[model samples]
Target: MNRVVRAAATVILLAILVPLLVLSSAAVGPAPRHWSGVSLSGWELPLVDARPRQEPGTVRAPHLDAVTDRLIARGDGGWQAVVPLHDGSVYVETTRLDPSLFAELGRDFGGDRVSVVYAPLAPQVSPDGGGGVPAQTLWQRTDPLVTWATLMFGFPWQLGAALLLTAVAYVVAARARRRRAAGTAAVPAG
Candidate 1:
């Protein structure tokens, strides 16, 4: 391929991928409610189960284990490390947990407990709240930049590194092709 063509293709590919990388990173980060949010700490709840939280009406795909599936799902992701609290179980979003920690939660799902520092993103009153009183609600990890950083290293970095390595490979292949062509041209021919 021509050098000009390859360079143009690389530029075009980057234009498409950079935005995708940014959008995806933001999508997987803490929900907007977690931005500048406060969290309740020193709370420990017995773990019930850990699984991907399927939104209503989403296509049902084959279920894979928790961590790898979430890593692949990226932006379209949700996880629940269910724990009993407030006289009922709350779907604690495990999106913020490190992959190792998330996997541990899954491993310990039914038989162990999890200590969490969480914030409720929204509260829905239990129907049995006795006259419209609010009940404990969905829990989310507090949105600190540091916690969000862990998620950044996942999809964005993986994609970025892959793109960069591809570019380097292209450059090496192009150079090797040029050297081979130059060598053939210098040889005596009948």
Candidate 2:
């Protein structure tokens, strides 16, 4: 009803809304294009140099070895090497054949013979009913309700600071109004 209350409400609302809007906007950026008809069996490993490839030292994929075994056993006419990228995505290198082990798969190193499949190392339920695999997009990977819950209730320090700022603003405005009223009251009822 008073200016102080209005100002306090505005401050609190802005404090809450600004961060929410920013995070939501970031999360809502253009939806990633999903590859249709893609299955773990169909994905192939890309060709790299003869140097030994390394998985990321941190964040190992729990099911990666199993998936690799399946891929190798399937003999799906593609070479598959699972290499972890710097950004946490696993690049499964797929080629038609092993260059050294099985020379029959074709050794043409012109880059056209290799295909790279990208997915996060985190396990996720398959959206296409093929089986569980790492999710390809933020929308598919994260539970919406859980994310909202964390955003609303998590980060106590940030919430506390915003509340403190709101209270301070309210107190300052109220004190100023009171001082003005007291000054006017002393002025001979003018």
Winning model by TM-score: 2
Predicted candidate 2 versus true structure: per-residue lDDT over 93-157, tens digit per residue: 44221222222211321112222332222343322353534434544343344334333333344
Count clashing residue pairs per candidate.
0, 8
Q: Write the per-residue lDDT of candidate 1 for residues 118-188, one digit (tens) a residue.
A: 22232232223335443322333333343344333433454566588767988899899999999999999
What lDDT does candidate 2 reach at residue 122? 33
Candidate 1 lands at a TM-score of 0.28
Q: What RMSD does each model have against the real structure?
A: 14.5, 16.8
TM-score of each: 0.28, 0.34
Candidate 1 error regions (>4 Å): 1-4, 16-51, 54-155
- lDDT (CA) for every model shown? 0.39, 0.40
